[model samples]
Target: METKFDSTADAVAAALRELIVGGELGGGERLVERDLAERFEVSRIPLREAIQQLAREGLVEVFRNRGAVVRTLTAQDVEEIYGLRVLLEGDAIFRSVKRLDEETLARAELVHRLLGEAATTQKQGELNREFHALLYGACGNARQLASIRELRAQVERYERLQNTLLADTPSFQDEHVAILQACHERNARRARALTAAHLDSARRIVLEVVERLAA
Candidate 1:
């Protein structure tokens, strides 16, 4: 029996995103419209809309013969995504540090604590996004923040790979502590540099694993 959703395109997209990011739908796997429509209990219109949405987010690609396929990130794609992230997120962190408020920092601290206690990768990822969003919310540039979010979504699958494959990956908790401390001290330069380095570290690890997986 298929579960039915009172589904809009966004709802459908969210469901598909969860499956894709969770690795239930692996790279290059075809998304058959009729099957997905039946599974999601949605009309073909919204299902197609959802597919287009994921395509725009770079999680899916619609080819001529293949309607929609989960995208497989190349090493080059990972490099480009993280390269933009370092630049954009670094700037956001710099600006946000200068504007950091006590209440916001306290909230970030709580999220950081929760992030440290997260038992699963899924929980950790959710809390990690919340922590970063709290810190960067003071940047005063909504467009930049939106772009940062889009970039993050693009590489979430790769981030999962890093968490699963690399046993010796550095503690993001330690880095978050350092970043939060910089924000508390209102050290914009240090926060920016740390943000860049943190993203760069993940990029390197993910790129190495992606290459190894390809080989």
Candidate 2:
């Protein structure tokens, strides 16, 4: 049982990352180690380890004497994150199409259903991330999945802005539906192209939001 519970630090790190990526934790927020340790019901050791991990991931920055704060993205950071998303997610789609199996297809369909439901409930941002994750989940390459996951986390702030600007927009659903249909048809090229287009659309909205936010 001790061994089973050994990864306390890692678990805390993942939880914090998810919170930040899900926008439950916002940019420029300061993280107090002792406070977080108490809040998470863990010892300082694991809490500090977790925060260090987040620091490495660019989610948090450590100051010599000021503690840690959530990293804020500049305009350049926004552009770079979106650019990486296009490259990684686009490649994942191309690879995922060829490796697509019954299990993967089913997962995508389920995610699609959840996305639609999320839209109806006005939780578009969460559903959008789920949809993107499902699209790349079948790539069958651990490193690729990990890289995409990191990029997604880094861009979460921009995504929130995009979702706000496009509130109640069903465009994402339509885009996702087209991509899934292409994958179902075994059209790898079409899937790849559609994924690029999907990223392009998101890039446009996010860029505008970033500009406004920066201003």
Candidate 3:
């Protein structure tokens, strides 16, 4: 398939995503196309294209009279996303655990350790993502994996905000260790339960941050 985006447009979109997620753009800030074009040193075409891309990703929305603005997510969004995560991720990991290979297990162990030491939200998010992917990637369901990735990208901003600004990120080391042990023991049921609880704990922590921010 032919790519729809040029390098500059893609770069513009990525930069915008970072700014918004990093809280540099601030929630509900108006995105004036001309101002953004000037700021990014890009033409109107790429700037508008980048906004449109973020819109599709649920990171930006345009009011009929308000043009484009950063989206201010709600507690409901967090609950819905992670409620689904419990089901989707639990099922995926359950399947993957039954099929785990030694190499993938080793990689996951290292990622879990890195995640424990990850001081910045960006590094923690990256390492945590890798650990989850290693756990779930063997599920034999490409579509499910893709959908989870998209949801994760949307939810990551809240996660980073919660951890980096509002409160210390909760350590998942115990849960991860338990889950890994269950997987190694070939106990799929225990692994699935642990994953569900893990995601639910995350949902609660993120919502606490969202409430504070909303206040």
Candidate 4:
């Protein structure tokens, strides 16, 4: 059976993932174990385990004795992540349309509601993740979904950074609604095109934001 510590550790991991994706904790920020342990109301052991898990996900880097830090994304990381996003999500949308059932589409609609709420409140980054995951899961390709999910997590760090700082970017809700509409119509081709376009737009916006921050 899972202990209370296990559950607490998982919660802390999720919360930290959100902070990272939301850019509350910026890139290269040091992760102090004891501080996090206190914040999460847990002990050091579980906190260390959570950090280790994040490291395996490529979202954190653990130094031998210096402790863990958020990984700093390079331009190359953004390029590769977006490139893979286009290939995987674009194809997944196409496949999903063919296999998607009414039930699945309805679930997707609900997920989009969450996305919209997130966008409206400027808390939609995580909801955006759920929206995409619902659509991708429809593809029924385990390996492909796994690969794309990893890429999504990697790029999301940058997306959060961009979204948090930009007051002028287009509404992410609208972008997601357009994709959902395409899926609702079962227009596979159009969905594929939109998926690619959405990712491309996100890449451009996020990269520009990163550049601005650097400047």
Candidate 5:
């Protein structure tokens, strides 16, 4: 039975995003409108709208005859996405660290603490976003922040994949602490370097997962 939602399209999109990011939908799997509409207990219009939303997020690809399919990430895609992230996020963190306010740092610390206690991968991912946003939000560049958000969205599925498969890895948590310390010390150069290295580590891990999946 599907849960009732006031805003059907938004709810449906959120549910589908969870499914896709959780790997239940899998890459390259076609999204059948009739089946999905029936599953979500939503009419075709809202179901279509939900799929279109995913498409805009780069999570789904719309085709003429084939309809919507989950977007599969290639090694090249990982390289490009993480490359841009390194550039944009590195600059953002650098600027943010130099202008770091006490309030933002305190909020980030709170989020980091909550992140450590988060039991579920989904919860951790959400907190991770909040923590990074807090740290980078001090950059005072709206367009740069927006660009970083878009890039993050594009690679989020892979991040979830890494968390699910490599649950024992504490590297991300450790790196977050190091990055936060840099921010605390107001070391813009170190913060930027750590941020770039952290992203590179994630990119490499995701690339390995993609390769393993292909194999």
Candidate 6:
């Protein structure tokens, strides 16, 4: 059955993701289907569908009798995600920079400036992804970008630990500027190096929070 907020499973999943990412839904907390259905004004069918979506994203876990609970990510998960990011995004930016003109790099710079002015964590996250997409979309491989997007979605669980992790810090500001400058210079090797360093730095920043949570 469907309800006002449950127009589609994607809608319900997005609602649930906001709660999880914003930390309202604590890790390991059991998801009571009946309660959530009532709260979201949706029927069990769509609510279940939403939970399943989150499960695929590694934010939810389901068991035969125990039902679903928020997944508690481990330190290893952080390592694996960022490791893959280094490979995927680093290479994409390398290819992208080789192909993009200075104008495209300037477009990404515009977003980078707005990223500096973002007031909230949510806005910061949005601009950050936008900047990357604009910066790397020129990689010209739809399949590569699709995989990168999936990895990014998975990393959002860690990224949203923003109270403890660095989301829009000055370090990020400086780094984004540097990366864009490299792109402006049309230095594929330098851009790839910067991207790799950026991903590693991010892995370190988020790993601290995730490891403690794991322990």
Per-model TM-score, in order, reads: 0.91, 0.85, 0.87, 0.80, 0.85, 0.86
- Predicted candidate 4 versus true structure: per-residue lDDT over 1-215, tens digit per residue: 85455776677888888788766788889999878888888888878888887787778999998889998777777888888889888999898886778887788788767554444323565556667877878788899987887677766666655344234334555677788888888899999998898888888767876677667
Name the top lDDT candidate. 5
Of candidate 2, the 10-residue stretch with the lowest lDDT total is 160-169
Candidate 3 off by > 4 Å: 1-7, 162-170
The residue-by-residue lDDT of candidate 6 on 65-126, one tens digit each, is 89999887678888888888889999899989878877777778888888788777767778
Q: After superposition, how far is residue 13 of candidate 2 from its true place, in Å?
A: 1.5
**What does candidate 5's lDDT look like per residue over 1-215, in tens digits?**
99776488999998998898777898999999999998999899999989988898788999999999999989998899999999999999998897878988999999988888888777887888899999999888999998887678766777777465237337788898999999999999999999999998888778888888888
Q: Rank the candidates by lDDT, best first.
A: 5, 1, 3, 6, 2, 4
Q: RMSD for all candidates, in order, please.
A: 4.8, 3.1, 2.4, 3.5, 4.9, 3.9
Better of 1 and 4 by TM-score: 1
Worst 10 residues of 3 by lDDT: 162-171
Instruction: List ranges where model 1 is wrong by over 4 Å.
Output: 1-7, 165-170
| Cα lDDT over the full model 1 | 0.84
Question: In candidate 2, what are the lDDT values of residues 134-177, reduced to their tens digit?
Answer: 76777878888888777767875666653552463568668888
**Best candidate according to TM-score:** 1
Candidate 2, residue 80: lDDT: 88
Per-model C-alpha lDDT, please? Answer: 0.84, 0.77, 0.84, 0.76, 0.86, 0.82
Alpha-carbon deviation at 59 in model 3, angstroms: 1.4
Residue range 1-215, candidate 3, lDDT tens digits: 88664889889999998888777887789999888899999999988888888888788998889899998879998888888888899899989998999899999999988888777888887888898999999999999997788677777777787454224444477888999999889898999999998887777777887899899
Backbone collision tally, model 5: 0
Comparing 1 with 5 on TM-score, the higher-scoring candidate is 1
Clash number for each model: 0, 0, 0, 1, 0, 0
